[model samples]
Target: MKALEPIDRTQRAQVVALTGKYIEQASRIFLRHFVMLPVFFDLSGRLAGMYKVHGRTRCIRYNPWLFARYYEENLAVTVPHEVSHYLTDTIHGRRGIRPHGKEWREIMALFGADDQVIADFDLSGIPGRSYQTEDYRCACRSHRLTHIRHNRIRRGWRYYCKSCNTELRR
Candidate 1:
């Protein structure tokens, strides 16, 4: 994670061109429904890019914030990642295959990607999802754990009390 870079004409052009090239290459490999797809950019915080197949028009909506931060580093993989997703979606005839299933993985490998299952970006500044907690009673005392921890106990991982060394029960 580096600071966000200022994406300019060169960066924008490169992203568009690279996406077009990958689309062409994928078309050559497999018969796709559409040959040409539009690339769009925005200042998105969560998503790096998205392969939107609306009716007949296939498009890539990317985050300019990422473009400003990592410039080409983000696009080099992100663009192809979205394209692979498009391939995965198209190959399955739209919406049934897993997002990062075997087909998508194969496509990534073909495009020189390392088969990365998820994005590798900085999310330290992003707010974490909070959870509610419940109190569980042990032989010695009561302890508070998140709902997930409580569920783990219910599912069969008997939590222990550190001080008393006893199993906490709900």
Candidate 2:
């Protein structure tokens, strides 16, 4: 199969416009004006979209590669998914509700979108980064910890094996 091209400028514009449209709808539905969060197409890997908050900053990120392959589905589902996250956070404080709890589902229903949490898409040709893994052992089995996890362990964090209920160690 030929490698699929990333989303073009026109598609990017459509995504931004759709995001704005959803924000407008959510404001009307909730009877409060919701700020327009920034939209970015810098995500990769299997995930389709993400709603992220860093301190006072908030933004929605999309995988351009996934959008190129599943344009319509991403437009219909991914847009609403991220928008719902934004609205949920805006209405209910972030720490007060679960990420996919009832409040989020209610918002999704109000938006007339499926409440399914994750996008299931084949990522055969998507460009992804490879992480170095470290080997660790538990009582029952060996495990491969990604570089991120290994660094956390180095910084006094601990991980456990589910089956053996033992701490993972180098």
Candidate 3:
């Protein structure tokens, strides 16, 4: 395993402090409606934010850099949007419903947030492939190669078209 560079302790402390402030503010806003509200700031997941079902927990899964990258105006709205998910969960009993639904949207509006929370990160289309795969059909003309075996084949083994005599990449 590769050794990692040490993190700046002061910067880590600052990030923790800022996250604590957000969690505290969110807790206060939701406490009136909820019997208990637990807010957590997670750094590991790709999810920007999620409300855990039945737990009444609102989680903001964003890197510490987001605090500096996004404006306070946007954070103010996003923080509440995630909180509203918790509120909706509490009200509706966390049943079969879309993650973001009509009930959640109304709650977000009532919380004095924007019509939509501007994300600090991308929630765009799915990630694209870096390289063409042998699993996929070859792009070369005259000879189209179809993958045969599911198992890995040995290198230097011929993958040529017997009909066209075109060599295919392994």
Candidate 4:
């Protein structure tokens, strides 16, 4: 790996824990000669699938629930796909340019991860339960709503809108 700064021991341990669990599941289908590196998994709005940051960490922003739903059956390949990035980065040092170039893709294939399958997934498209409400509209006006549960509403008082008298959609 490039001479990048090391991550905190605790953070590295957490990554190992998650990586080990994924590896245990993946080893049955792929090679098991790799180790997890410490990296930050920044869950932001601008991510496309998983990526490596600072040459040490793998960052993926998929929703835990949605990811489990999609990859629960083949979790190992997905994990290896991400690890392949780490491996490729280390081998090439800082000279690595293309994110999913030929070398990285080859590494993924070696680890039994299908590049096509990983490419088919639009990681950003996975639906996550919104803790923030989507925009709502009534008449000519539109506004955002709270994400409170339906059970939290107190009877008939819930239907009336604070902006206008428009009865809101549930």
Instruction: For each candidate in the order shown, give its overall lDDT on alpha carbons.
Output: 0.78, 0.93, 0.50, 0.51
How many pairs of residues collide in model 2? 0
Off by over 4 Å in 1: 1-6, 31-34, 123-170
Model 1 residue 21 lDDT score: 86
Q: List, residue by residue over 2-106, the lDDT tens digit for candidate 3.
A: 422222456445444554554455557657434434444443223444556534344444333343333353356555666667567766756786667888887
In terms of lDDT, model 1 sits at 0.78
Q: Please list the residue runs of candidate 2 whose C-alpha ends up more than 4 Å from where it truly belongs after superposition.
A: 134-170
TM-score pick, better of 3 and 4: 3
Using TM-score as the measure, the top candidate is 2
| lDDT (Cα, tens digit) per residue for candidate 4, span 56-159 | 45454322333333443324454566666666665665475577788778777766667754333444544433666655566547766665533344344455
- Give every collision pair in model 1: 4-68, 4-69, 5-68, 5-69
Candidate 2, 1-170: lDDT as tens digits: 78788999999999999999999998787788999989999998888999999999999999999999999999999999999999888889899699999999998899899999877889999977788999999999999999999999999999999998999999
TM-score of each: 0.64, 0.81, 0.47, 0.43
Clashing residue pairs for model 4 = 39-57
TM-score of 4: 0.43
Counting clashing residue pairs in each candidate, in order, gives: 4, 0, 0, 1
Backbone clashes in model 2, listed as residue pairs: none
Best model number under lDDT: 2
**Tens digits of per-residue lDDT for model 1 on 1-170?**
66444477878888888888888888887865546577787546667778887787778888777667666667667888988888777777656677888889899888897667567778544323467999998888899999999999888898889998899987
